[model samples]
Target: MIVFFFWLSIFIIVYTYAGYPALLYLLGKACRKTKEYEDYEPSITLLIAAYNEEDFIRRKLDNSLNLDYPSEKLQILVVADGSTDKTAEIVQTYESRHVELCFQPQRQGKLAAIDRAMAFARGDIVLFSDANNIYEPGTLKSLVVPFSDPTVGGVSGAKHIIKDENTLGESEGLYWKYESFIKKQETRLGSCSGVSGEIFAIRRALYEPAPRHIINDDFYLAMRLLRRGYRIVYVPQARSFERTSYSKKDEIIRRKRINAGRYQALRYFRQIFPLKYPRLMWQVISHKVFRLLLPFAMIVAFLTNGLALVPGLSKGEPSILRLTFPFNWIIFSIQSLFYLLSVIGNISAGKQGKLVYLPTFLVNSNIASFQGFLQFIKGNETALWEKVKRADNGEQINA
Candidate 1:
């Protein structure tokens, strides 16, 4: 029984991160076909929900105004709800440029703000964005091209993190790159379940309002469309760039909020059972559900692995089975080393090596996931979240 648990835990961890992606890669290659798209210039409403975003609001508006899309067809809407700063003032200044502003004195969270602003949206497609996301000039053009295919109900763009020798930045950038690869494979296999909130667009007509309590609005919105038999295409060419959180603490807060939202989203996605929606169910279970459950599996693997090393720990085991002790020691040692590296990386704060970054990120993120689960249980996390400070200190450079 001890050995059974240890191996089961190990398989859960390995299969979540590695085996699932490997399966997707092989399946992607088998079902690969040239994706067909055309010049699709649908009327788009660029919706940016901001709260006390004085620092980046101007830059974001400027970037939006100068995008490659036709200004006549594109409507840039800024919703500054619960903003007590110059965020509203700055957005108001852009009124002459035909930039729409939706402001409310009370802070009711992002979902609420979008709900209020949705009444003013007049575009065929609505592209959601963050105040910090700086897109390439051609991003708008690329993002809309997929809508040319009626089957493509939504389009999610790629996110590139701008790193500047910051350890957290490096880890985040690497994480996004890995996510991009998986998203590409998932899209090739039919559709992608994940969508970066920083850059994603869906038809305004297909948009069913998600619950106001929803935390990960982007994922919830995308999955809603997917549930309706619509495909969500990931367009790598439509890239948005942003810097990492100002510090590890900030990133932890952001990740905890996100993971908590993932937990919250599970109840809403209950219809995606294996029998009803096999491929979608497998993707969600492998890509999202298993990843959320990994930290617990790690805990089980560690505890069971340790107990397996002790003599006669498994009550019914015969003395002859003691030969397995050596293998247990090896596995235990590897786990210990990983935890030790995480400790070392945390102690050496700003180091920029893969040895430090990978272990620290893996451990810290898993711990955050555990914490997030607790938050979800406590019902402490809400749609209204604190803004995470970014490493970019007011630089206006385009990526």
Candidate 2:
């Protein structure tokens, strides 16, 4: 029994973090690349959903206007969902310049806002973006390129975390870099299970009105496309830049909301399991389900290792067992150190000058996941958007 538990813990951790990714890389490499279509220029509508984003609206609008796509083929729609601030005014300021401003006094939710915005969008493709993220100059062109393939129903752009002097900034940026690498590998395999909310493009024909209660509309929408036999491509060259959350507290709030969305997604997408969607089940399980359970797996590993350390529990075992005892201590010690660093990272985030606070960021994320899980169980998680403070060029916004 002890040996079974021990091996199980090891397998969970290794398969979740390392083995799965290795298998994905191998399988991705084995798949044949689809032929590229060159003469594909489809009309695109850029949809921006804003809620009390006064500070960043103008900049986002300016960036949208400057996108490299042909002006005639581009349409910009900004939906101000119950903003009691200057968000509506800022978007209205761009009305004369091909920007359509949609404002509703009642705030239903983000999905509702998106649905309302889509009604006004007239284009072959609809691209969704957040109000705070800034798209690179040629982001639209790169994002739309993958749609040349008729099977490609949706495309997700890479998120680029702008680096700053703060440790949180460094950790956030590094985490995104790692996520981007994994996304690329998953895309190469076939389709990534989810895409960044900041940037994703979908065919207008595939657009469906998401349930108003959906927390992660972007994820659900993209996954829905995949479920309908559409390919979801990851376009790395299409970039969206945004700052890390202002502080650890703010970051926690953001992550908790995201984790809650993950839980909700699991419940909604229960059909994409191992026995159900056999063809794409491996990708979905590896990319989405495993990630949601990783924190619990970490806890299981720690507890199982602790149990194995008790003297009488496995006494007089093989010499190999005794030799491996110290290794367990070392692993536990490292985990403790990581937690300590996370605490330090939280404390020193705004004040310190360090460039890498990986330990702090990682620990904080897990902590948020725990809180998010509790929220999910209590039915406290909602589709309501919670704003995170943003930093632009070293200055903090009231967001």
Candidate 3:
């Protein structure tokens, strides 16, 4: 038990901090930097899915209209899925003025809306954007530059989490910065396991209509491209900004939904075994599969450590075991403290205050992962969208 505890703790730490980053660094070192191009313009369609986003639809249209691409080369499509608000109306207000609005009165999920929008897209490349996120002026130019490589089928932009004075925002921003770094490395190696849904582009020829029930269309679409022997490159210079969850509770709901998607993807794509898909195997296993299992690993580590400390487990070396007990206790104490901080973070977030709560955010993410597993097992996981409340300002974060 003692041996198991020691190794498990080491594994958790290494996997989370050391192993992931090291793999990314090595991959980044191996990847050839994308080359510059002077005449790389490609006709592009920008697809945005809006669900009751009346407040932000006009801004989104304004942002699209101001993109640095040629007007004749750019086409913008907005799909308002069962939006009861003025979202569809607001988008239609910009019709023939560089925007087109597609409305479905009956409520369907995001994937369905995207599918309907894709049928009408005429561009060689289709870029997906969310209603709430705003792209930088030249983001489109940089996003498309990567596709100049024939091997590249899809491209994703860096997600910048807008930082706020609130603790929830700070923690979320920090977490995403770390994630973006990892993605950069993964792209260098070959392809990232997933792409941010907020800002990503795919060749229309390589586009596959996501299933109506698919929860994470961006990840699924990226993986499909990989399966077809195409690379998904990450463009760090291209950026999209959006607000973090308004509070810890909102963050939890959003994360749990995403975790549920992770579980679903794992089940759906089990055919990409380690031996068969060796190159991408590590990326998927480490980034998605192992992450889903981490909460259980934490539990096992704690229980095994506790069992090792009990009497009769270490019969011959009572003194040695006793001396090590404090170390085990210290580790367990830290784990508990992290949980406490998470609770504090959640409470503080409800009151809209900053608490420098990294430990809390980490614990909360794992807890949500565990809950997502339960939801998946119970068959309660649905692809239906659940919108999380966001910060009022609609700023972008670098998390």
Candidate 4:
């Protein structure tokens, strides 16, 4: 039973991180590339939800105004609900640029802000954006092209973490690159399971006001479209850039909140099961569900492997190396070394190369996920989210 559990845990970790992506790669090769997108220009409302984002709102409005899309066709709306700072004031200044501001005095959370703003949105497509998302000139054009296909219900653009001198920035940039690849592959396979909240668009008519408790609004919104039998694809060319989290600690806070919301969102996706939608079910389970179970699997693998190495020691074994020779010597050694490096990397906060960053990031992320699970169980997370600080005070680098 010990050996069985050890192997099962190892399998879960491997399949979640590696095997699933490999399988997607192989299956995606058989799927033909979609070339149905055209020079499509549908009326779009660029909705920016701002909550005390005074640091980023001005630049974000400027960026939005400079987009290559026709000004007449695009309606720039900034929803500053419960913002006590100069966010609403700054947005008001943009009124001369034909930018609209919808300010609600009470802080009802992001979903509520979006819901209220949607009522005044005068576009066929609603593009959800964050204050920190700096768009390239052609991003808007690329984003809507996929909508030319009637089946495509929503489209998510790629998010690039601007690489900085810090190791965290580099690792985060690499992580997003990996995610972008997976989204591309998933899009080719048919539908992407989720989207980046920073940049995604859905038909305005399909917008539904979710319950006040829906914490992971982006995933819930995207999946709701899928549940309605519409396809959501990844648009790699529609790129927006933002800096990394202010620090490792901030990253963990952000990740924990996201993961907690993901756990809470499981109930919303209950109907998208294997029997009704086999391919989608496989994708969601492999891509999203397995991640939620990973920390537990890691704990099981570590404990089981450690226990397997204890028998010889109980028999008064002399050398530490000789204790587990017949049992889990190799696996135990690898785990031990990996964790040692993780400890060192954590202390140093990833000052080293990919060798350290890989383990540091992997361990920290899993810990955050576990913390998020606990938060979800305890109902500690709320719909109103506090913003995580970004590196360099959320300044936009030239994309």
For model 2, the stretches where C-alpha displacement exceeds 4 angstroms are: 1-3, 270-276, 317-324, 349-356, 393-399
Question: What range of 10 consecutive residues in model 4 has the weakest lDDT sum?
Answer: 313-322
CA lDDT, every model vs. true structure: 0.87, 0.79, 0.79, 0.86
lDDT of 4 at 281: 79
TM-score of each: 0.96, 0.92, 0.91, 0.94
Q: Report lDDT (Cα) of residue 159, candidate 1.
A: 94
Give stretches of model 4 more than 4 Å off.
Answer: 271-275, 312-327, 393-396
RMSD of each: 2.2, 3.0, 3.0, 3.1
lDDT of 3: 0.79
Residue 364 of model 2 has an lDDT of 80
TM-score of 3: 0.91
Ranking by TM-score: 1, 4, 2, 3
Tens-digit lDDT track of model 4 for 1-399: 666788889889999888988888888987766556677999999999889999988899988998999999999999999999999999998888899999978998999999999999999999999997799999999999989988889999999988776777877888888888888889889889869998999999898888888888888888778888888999999999988888888999999999999898886666433336789879988988999999999999899888877764323344333334544777888898888877877788436888888887888899999999999999898998968888875445676
Quote the lDDT for 186 in model 1. 93
Clashes in model 1: which pairs? Answer: none
In Å, residue 320's CA in model 3 sits off its true spot by 9.6
Q: Candidate 3: list runs displaced more than 4 Å.
A: 30-39, 271-275, 314-323, 349-356, 394-399
